[model samples]
Target chain A: SAVISQKPSRDICQRGTSLTIQCQVDSQVTMMFWYRQQPGQSLTLIATANQGSEATYESGFVIDKFPISRPNLTFSTLTVSNMSPEDSSIYLCSVGTGGPNYGYTFGSGTRLTVV
Target chain B: AQSVTQPDIHITVSEGASLELRCNYSYGATPYLFWYVQSPGQGLQLLLKYFSGDTLVQGIKGFEAEFKRSQSSFNLRKPSVHWSDAAEYFCAVGAAKLIFGTGTRLQVFP
Candidate 1:
């Protein structure tokens, strides 16, 4: 399986501050994804990080608020801009190995708490 | 859009007993279904997945799931439960992005 490592495992930030979470993969491949898990809730797809192209956000998520940057195949970053209390959740990064060969693997996740 | 549903929110079973977790999906076309397990304060791990062919699929940790297209269901089952099997299990369906169920919390007693 793909191994993904994410930065800032947990953070507590002020309401007006912002946080940028980084995810790095061990191997180069396509189809990187960002997901958010709200309090006691299921994981929701935030966006798909396509290398050398803009990310495709989900229905409810927007690009401006959650700016995603996929510099290359092995790295991607998700920035939570102007965070609020409602933004407090666990942000996860997943890496896929093309088709169903290896499936998707998630990082330890960043637990963000906005006050 | 693809959606997944897990009927049970919580399940308690004793060690050496059989275990089952039910999941249903809604998609017009054939969809990829997956079951993931998460331990306390840990990331989610893929327990098993059903993509195409072979209705019965075996996965890690002595787990298996059957995909029934007619029933729109993919249920996880194990013949014998281990105390270490206690965790939250999530069922998902997708292609680009996954639609996940609320997850089923399992508790095992000795």
Candidate 2:
């Protein structure tokens, strides 16, 4: 098991502003992912951040909307650019090791409310 | 395309009662299945997962699930419910890129 933490556990921002959420893991992990949970909806994968490489985004998600940065094995940041009320929701970061079947550990999540 | 489905939107259960949450998936191949719990104002925590062999998998916090390949289902169950168990539960499939279901919100009453 690993202890994961996110900064700005909860935040409220004005529309058109951008916020960068930070994810730090207690130990080094190979795979770090960013997810978005819309109000009353399921979570959607935003992208996968790997050290020394650009993030891999899902079909509906793009780097321009959600820019990601992975500077090391244990840390990653996701910047929600051009925020809107629709972007108000919980953002989660999960860390996992690659394999056929493996477990995932997630940060407590950042609750963002864009007004 | 890979997708996960959690049919139930909200489930209310009395405390100390048994509980079961339904989930189903559609994928091209044998898929990895997982159950995760998210308390209000908290990130999601892994409840259990099934990747292969064992059809039944045990998870922390007294949660268990069984995988049915024929039905494309992985359902979560608990013998007795606790008020603390009131939270949102999500079912996910796929290993590299997890596709999560809409989620089931569990409500517990005294």
Candidate 3:
């Protein structure tokens, strides 16, 4: 399993501002996933970040709104653009440990509050 | 499409009591099932997961889950509930990308 260090553990920003959340994995991985967990809601996949390629966003999410960067196998960043109160949520980064029955490792998460 | 369902939105149990949290999932093939616990103001922790072989899998913190193929279910259980066990539980199904259930919040009373 890999350990992820996600920073800005939390932040408060004004509406229309943007925040970039970073995740650094101790070990290299092929794909990293970004998720949004709204208050009192289940986690939703925002996008899949693959090294050396443009991130693949989920249907309801877009690159402009939630741009992702996977500069390498061990690091990725997700930026929430043009923030609104509705954008307030916990953002998490995850990586799958490759094996027959491997599980995914998640970052501590970033709690963002848009005022 | 893969989807997970946790019918119970909230559950309350007395400390030291046995606990069970129901989870159901829909997927086309043999699904990768997982149970994760999220404490207040903390990250999501993987409790248990079922890939294959054993129908009943043990996880950290005395948590276990049984995967029933026919029922399309993967329910989490614990022999005794502790105060620290109170948290939000999510059931997810998938391999690369996970589809999570709405989640069940557990409340333990002494």
Q: Which model scores highest in TM-score?
A: 3
Candidate 1: which docking quality band? high
Off by over 4 Å in 1: A99-102
| lDDT values, one for every candidate | 0.92, 0.90, 0.94
Full candidate order by DockQ, most accurate first = 3, 2, 1
Model 2 regions lying over 4 Å from their true place: A99-101
Q: Which stretches of candidate 3 lie over 4 Å from their true place?
A: none
What TM-score does candidate 2 reach? 0.94
Give TM-scores for every candidate, taking all chains together and pairing residue i with residue i.
Answer: 0.96, 0.94, 0.98
> Which candidate's DockQ is highest?
3
**First chain of candidate 3, TM-score:** 0.97
Enumerate the candidates' DockQ scores in order. 0.84, 0.89, 0.91
The sequence of per-residue lDDT tens digits that candidate 2 reaches over residues B5-106 is 788899999999999999999988888888989887778888898888889999999999999988999999999999999999999998677889999999
* lDDT of candidate model 2 versus the reference: 0.90
lDDT of 1 at A79: 96
Query: To one decimal, what is the Cα RMSD in angstroms of model 2 from the true structure?
Result: 1.6
Q: Provide the TM-score of chain B versus the true chain B for each model in turn.
A: 0.97, 0.97, 0.98
